[model samples]
Target: MHTPAPTAPAHARPRAVHWLTTAAATAAVIAGAALLQPAAATASPDTAAAAQARPAPDAQAATYPLECRGGAPRVVNRATGDLDGDGHLETVAVVRCDAGIGTPPSGVYVLTSPHRVVATLLDPGDGENVTEIAVAEGAVAATLLGYSSDAVARCCPDRMQKVKWQWRNGKFTRSATPDARGV
Candidate 1:
């Protein structure tokens, strides 16, 4: 009875090995990216300067109303500026496209008083969803009106942007937007 069967020749083997390798490699790469996290937000020179330049968060409140709109409904840094004014500052919006008054599009969110923006009953206006939202610095008061039925693409920040972005190490970063001619 017998000798053990010999191993199959490479040519006789199933191509399934190649397919399995490709699938495994692809899955590994996807997993790596999904698990990747942004580097810790180190304070840049500008951040340091901004911190030094602005008044203490509490001190600037009475003078500027230093409202912030990000990272939950907490108070702002206190000494911050209009940030792009789109009425609210980036601090309050948490990111761009903040929904200051209602549950706006998903990207950015504008912060209101802890209790203010609670239940945005969709156009349930009557000041129910129309919370005291922020607007651009020079924007008209009428523009502060909130939407009711649905959010339209018209919600993109109305602030005129003069972004002067630069490609840094394969990424874009902006130093500032120069003053506009008439703006």
Candidate 2:
């Protein structure tokens, strides 16, 4: 017959459990604090300083690829963000012809540093007007307003679409958002 091992007194059991629980909680707190620390810097100090010193591309200085009938292209709305994951900011501008009365189609253009137009995300020839445009998380998003048919008036858009463009495979790919619908 095996002899039973001596157990701690009942009064000490609670204290033992409390000590274990406290130890576990202290360990958890240490691990969490370690995780909260900033990661090691991957970029050099000079590179980081240069990136911070350089401002994002200016929308007003870049020339758009829209052909307006005697009127110049004007930037209506613009947003700046890093669209290529290159740590440099780019400008996304929603531009349209400076029309006197009617609404003109808007073109979305991406501009890089030094105010150079790098890509045209949207062409004005598509006959769609961008009401809202934004750049975030290395992507460009816009709300386009368009006519359903020729009978629809230009001033009143019957079709509404939300689109996003992300840099992929050496080019920007467009995708429609799930909530995109006509108004």
Candidate 3:
């Protein structure tokens, strides 16, 4: 006659059940985490086509409006983003007159495809230098260094201003950021 296998001891039974419960809970957690994970991104055909159709404007190839006093305007800093929600990238370039001595003020220009200057965000005539520039979420931000007065030396800027530009209503609007303060 066939005989049944021996079972776990009476006192050990609870421990075995607890171990199994813990394992099941751990498995359930793992499964839940897997379900909560974000799905991998896949580009749609239209997005791929749009990307191919429009590329970021070349900052180096564009001609700026700044009069360099017979010297060439140089691109000092550049950032790219779709500033106008046009589904195409635009280039924001910080340009300055190539000077040998003191700090020359910078002009911020926006360039569209084909390397055309479409907007001048910061004019060199404004007498401020761009210390930093960035583009994000269809907006351009910059830290400007300037003098407190005509008495201040050009080499030393005593004022610091943080500014931002966003495209709205067919034009770019300028706003001072919260962190603007004296340097």
Candidate 4:
């Protein structure tokens, strides 16, 4: 008879208490995670839309030397280098415009930031084409390939002009090299 108090018949209340405790802990953890979410992630869709409608800050908005037309300029070639020796990697992209049936307008653009085209390295006319572009020695070397004259058809370029672009006075200056070749 010292055998015992019968342990209260293994009360179901204890099991219920344990389940409630686990449920409360799980809810707390989930609530904490939602509160700690990033501002953008927690924002409502309308709030996000309103934020996007606001103008970009000046520090974030860079001014470009040239403007693209017809649509967002199409990037044909791209390279990366410290073009201005600023220790920051600058982007050199050869962009072309679909102006008309003739050779598309094209140019070399340098960007310190993605949203801005900081400099126009080489701008080819409506019928001119930029065949090749490269970045070296903090300078841009571009090959202007296009018809020799206005009479030449749009089949293939007949003349190849080599041009060098250098960064100077906070801008780009183009110089025609003597290596004009024929394709």
Candidate 5:
């Protein structure tokens, strides 16, 4: 006679299946906890490694070249002084102011050569505007003040380039007044 294979009972089989399902659920929870961690909540092992991989915020550029379009540069005036603090004015920095007249555009620049900018500064303020620029002795002095335009005024002019370079006793200062009339 051939023997028959034994079979598991339905009731106990279901209980055993329940324990297996519980173990699988627990494993899933542990796996999810491992993956759901907040990165910045604690200083984990790789803090130094992270710092090495990022750039410092305070880093600056070492050198920059100067180039611009729409305006050419020239030295309109020159003075004698030690502007660069090297005891001589051989290193000349040029400055210029461009303005708008009805249909023309305006801008300003400080130049160290025919094509170099030692420093570029904004040329407008609360009660003043730079209209003319010249370099002397190594220093850049610009004419500034309120000026009258046909669009802004009518009678008595009431405007002029109010300041000039006062190179006194090897030192320079800006003097201002009024009456800067322009188009």
Candidate 6:
């Protein structure tokens, strides 16, 4: 005759099973704690310091190109034309400066050669803002918006003057009459 093997009650498991469950729970808790840590906490000291020293995207130090530092040269407007009449297109960049408070200084840079600044057409604080800039037919025109007189508020522009610079004799000159429609 055949005989059946003995078995434990359903409510009670083997001692080995209890130890296995406890080990799994402990591992899960450790994994959760590891995942909860901040990324900076895992970074090296040098990496953390570099991240802190980095400038904000909009900061003046970040805005200006490596070559130009004067006036903090934040390029607000740009145009391309044969500004020097060399049959090659030159760049005209209107930049704003970070000078103290109020309206920062502004200027225009003429790039006769590629990536090389040849001359500064306008200086900062000469006007409130460079409303528009364009180069056409060997002439560069800039619309300067600013107070007509000291009596007017610095924030308000009582006049809009159109200035023209013509490329001649290896340099640019201010023209008395500005082109009405600057290209």
Q: Can you write out model 4's per-residue Cα lDDT over 51-110, one digit (the tens) per residue? A: 345432231233434355664445777776667765556677776654545446676667
Report the number of the highest-lDDT candidate.
Answer: 3
Q: Could you give candidate 1's per-residue lDDT for residues 1-183 as a string of tens digits?
A: 799999999977879888898899999999998899678798645654654554322321222212335733333221123333223322222121234564432211222222122111112112211222333342111112223334423343333323222224533233423542221
Q: Report lDDT (Cα) of residue 4, candidate 5.
A: 91
For model 5 the local lDDT of residue 122 reads 30
Candidate 2 Cα outliers beyond 4 Å, as residue runs = 1-49
Candidate 5 deviation (Cα RMSD): 19.0
| Better candidate number, 4 or 5, judged by TM-score | 4
* lDDT scores in order: 0.34, 0.89, 0.92, 0.68, 0.42, 0.66
Candidate 6: tens digits of C-alpha lDDT, residues 1-183: 878887778757658888899999999999999999767756445633543453212222222332344545567877767666444666777777655566654677776433666677787647657878887776888787766578887776777678888888888887645433322
Error of 3 at 89 (Å): 0.3
Candidate 2 matches the true fold with a TM-score of: 0.73
TM-score of each: 0.21, 0.73, 0.73, 0.55, 0.29, 0.53
Using lDDT, rank the candidates from best to worst: 3, 2, 4, 6, 5, 1
Clashes of 4: 0
Better of 2 and 4 by TM-score: 2
By the lDDT metric, which is better: model 3 or model 5? Answer: 3
The sequence of per-residue lDDT tens digits that candidate 5 reaches over residues 23-88 is 999999999999997787665546445434433221012122323246433232322233444432
Candidate 6: residue 170 Cα off by (Å): 1.7
What lDDT is obtained when candidate 5 is compared to the true structure?
0.42
Positional deviation of residue 65's Cα in model 6 after best superposition, in angstroms: 11
Model 3 — which ten-residue stretch has the worst lDDT?
A: 43-52
Q: What is the C-alpha RMSD of each candidate to the true structure, in Å?
A: 21.0, 13.9, 13.3, 11.2, 19.0, 14.2
Candidate 2 colliding pairs: none
How many angstroms is residue 157 displaced in model 1 relative to the true structure, after the best TM-score fit? Answer: 54
